[model samples]
Target: MSSLSEIITSSLQKYNDRPAIWVDDCVYTYGDLSYYINQIRNVLHQQLTSPALKGERICIWAYRSIDAYVGILSGVLSGMPYVPLNPRFPDERNLSIINRVRPKAIIVDKNCEDAASKILPTIKFPLLVFFPSYTQKPKWCSLIKQHQFFSQEELISYPLASISNLEVGSVVNTDSSDMLYILFTSGSTGEPKGVVVSHGNVFSYVNGINTISDCHYDDRYLQHIDLTFDLSAHDMYCSWCSGASLYVTPHNLILFPNRFISEYKINKCMLVPSTAGVIQGHNLLFPNSMPSLKYTFFCGEPLTGSVVNGWQKSAPSSIIYNVYGPTEATIAFTYYKCTGDSVDRCLPIGKPLINQQVIITSSSETAADEIGEILLGGSQVALGYWENEKMTDEKFYSHSGKRWYKTGDLGKLDPNSQDIIFLGRSDRQIKVRGFRVELGEIESVIRKIAKTYFVAVLGDSDSEYENVLGGEGYLNVVALVANSQESKENIIEECKKILPDYMVPSQVIFLKEFPRNSNDKIDYKEITKIYYKNKNSSSISAHNNVI
Candidate 1:
């Protein structure tokens, strides 16, 4: 058996009677999760004619759904790389991903049937569609001729499998170097970049996290992040590695998860700092309100001191940790365990995990306090971008026979403590409510929508909502336009159809002419300055619902 699959099977057997996961009212024990995973795998073997499923890609329609978890494991146990397709994404974005991956099969639940139906026709491959949540054959099956569809009937008919009885020859042949999953992140070059993470990368991460993290069988973890996000992957594996129960907050509840976390007695939660910012903004956190919480993990965005203060007070018993890493390096490599008190607005990201190594270009650990771009290297680092050799070569490089990935984030090591302190991005990309957004992609979409040549999208990272807009760390995408006949409302509506809601501008600013640098390039700094100068000027701005 592959090392990754063995780790999973061993956990299932060891924690047979323990609660493993919860999605809404659906609770699964370790044994139940095992049976469901086996059922899905059996269905796949029987339905798909392809005998060699190893290394094949299986797209999982995921969002805190049972089918998502089961499908992901079925792929892992069956030697298939699982790709997550979030239905909440714009159809265009979802379709683009499908076109790029051309997955061997797609696993989705009843909730995702409508979206699957819409995307099925465009899929050129003979894709197998598994609907473990559907009671019967999908109604859209006959309407779509390109893919094969299976219902829960197939899954129920399959025999259950155990660790010892699992077919070793047919499945579980994944090499440590084999791709475990491909996660798509926003790219500055208009297309989303597919980051390929190997089974070894994930295994190394899970092993490293287990060493320092205090998660245990008694701990109940909150899977508050989206399945589409890389942090969700970390939460799932880390919880399982420790034999802990994972309580998944439905995607609908992630925006405001206080009630669910309190109700479930979730002792551990993985949150983006922006989510904490919004929660604090709404005055939902009272002192010792979440005493049941034992560990509060912050990632995806900067964990500010103010946000940490509020969360620490609310979940006073919880240990707060601020983690840092790009999608290119499997979930995270660096984590800072927060103390009782914080003085800086932005807290330190701290040291790297045991299996990982980081380097700040033009700086060193011996340096008093030198700032530079953070570069990552080690077992946790992902293979590279999928199907894009040019980009792969550009981003990943070798130094002294060790591979290194440029993180693009600007940072420095604290002179005194030597902990890595995160400054900010060195590129156009910014975290809009914890979701990565490329300002250039948003601009490209706007240019296409408005049929205008001159359009620039600036990330308003220091907006009022940097702390809260009743949403996750909300960076308002401000669209600055010079030539466009389309009304701001029309442009906003069109953007919603093509781009993710976060990428859509909360406000549109019309400029007669763009400020240019000496090189005659658009001066984003000057435009941002102009934006702050006219922050409240209605004559130059059109506002959308920020939240």
Candidate 2:
């Protein structure tokens, strides 16, 4: 299909009664989902009479809900791009995105109405659509009565029933090159940068993965990731386009992923490695706990062997894949199938996806088994950062007549296996005493020795106290470990055995948990704050002798 609207409409006709989405205690059939889409499309039309709204961005407060899904699909169906603002984000961050995109309208579900209400007034003449949940209302629901509210029951009854009778086409035919959505990633310039992805970019990705994987009509795919994360785009569209069911994990059960999978009998899933690590850290995996799980796809972070091995032992029938890609290259374009017995105890990110090309570049040449910046050339590489020409020109470049996105990640092809082994981010590489160090390499060694999935190694040799601590800088390696049984000194000694003296962490800190950010990944900034606060403490000084 050329457009997601076409994909949805086609699925509606084919699987009319089949369950399309399962959230909480509700199961919405394809017909039910399509009906709501039509009603929402009509609702959007009634409110968005301004022709200027067409082709502009419509920001949606994305969360786990039937309305949240319909709102995005509906906006795309209305021939406008959608910007998903996670309700969990701070008002300032959301406001920054709003100001940057300058969306014509905003859509919010009941869970986010309070947050959206406070933000909507900041924009001029902004049209708002509020989708109230059948289960509950926001705490401030009673205070605001002027906004338009559409509940599931209200959308299915009376005037909406008439909406079904009206010969209106829900699918709006736009050029496949049109921007479908813009997802903002943390920018190096303090302000977030919006990654512009066209319908063609996503269409190629969904079709490419489906062609190789077992994502078919019979599978019930789980949607546990937050919608704002680009991985959710893969979760929703991949399952929907294949006519499979998409199950949203309950907020209460997100922390307990094993239960979510077993209870839902999910056959397919895609999630970050950290979520799996959480399950492994808790020893939550029981024998055959998730027998129904078939295809397990992991991305957004490095997939470690111990985590996947433990997971593999529990779900013996499943095939675990390590999928890797950046937001600029659509959801993910590289595919790596983990065999559980991977060398170096870490899974290779593997080759490129179908209709995509992966090359490692150093200086002016691309070669195998060479450590260099990874470049992606394919249909999946994005249009560039939204409205930022200078930034776009810097990352997205035309090489040999094909547009290639320069993934700042450092990786090299295995001379023997030809698979890509990701090193780490090129920009994140730091120098210690004139020696280059990759934080991920240190974290990798920590994960292997600690037998734990969550590990973060932070260091900076250019701090103010550098003159006193060491030659250039402090040269301090602060290893933040989670759920590891090894003592701080033992962990430091283990690193000293395998890693060089300079690479060994000057201090090792143990925590029951590592603080996580909005993306549910380890919050390095928070850890940095804690690190600095304790840098001068006597307790840390006692452990400095280990270095």
Top candidate when judged by lDDT against the true structure: 1
CA lDDT scores, all candidates in order: 0.79, 0.73
Instruction: Write candidate 1's Cα lDDT for 1-547 as tens digits.
Output: 3377777777788898999999868889988887777777776665553347777889988567888888988888787888898877788888888888888888887677778778787777788888877888777687777777777886787555443435432456667888899989888877888999998888888887776677578888888877778998887888777678888887678766667777888887888888788778777778987878887888988788888888888888888889888888889889999976886477889999896888889695467588899999888888999999999999898776667899888889887787998888788878887888878888888888878866888766555455542222455688988777888889998888877777889877667777788999888888777776666564334323111
**Per-model TM-score on C-alpha atoms:** 0.93, 0.76
Task: State residue 529's C-alpha deviation in candidate 1, in Å.
Answer: 1.0
lDDT of 1: 0.79
Model 1: lDDT of residue 470: 21
* Candidate 2 C-alpha lDDT tens digits along 1-547: 5676688678877888998999867999888876677766665666665344467887888578887787787777777899998766656567778888887666677677767768665555445545535433344545545444455455455243334322234455666678889988755433557889988898889878976687678888888877667888887888878889999988777667778888778888887665676566567778789999898998876667766877787787888898888889988889898865544255788988887998888623345566899999988999999989999999998877767999888888887788888886766444343233567767877888888977887774434323222111224567878788788888887776555465688877776667799999888878776666656563443433222
Superposed by TM-score, candidate 1 places the C-alpha of residue 276 at a distance from the truth, in angstroms, of: 0.7
- Highest TM-score model number: 1
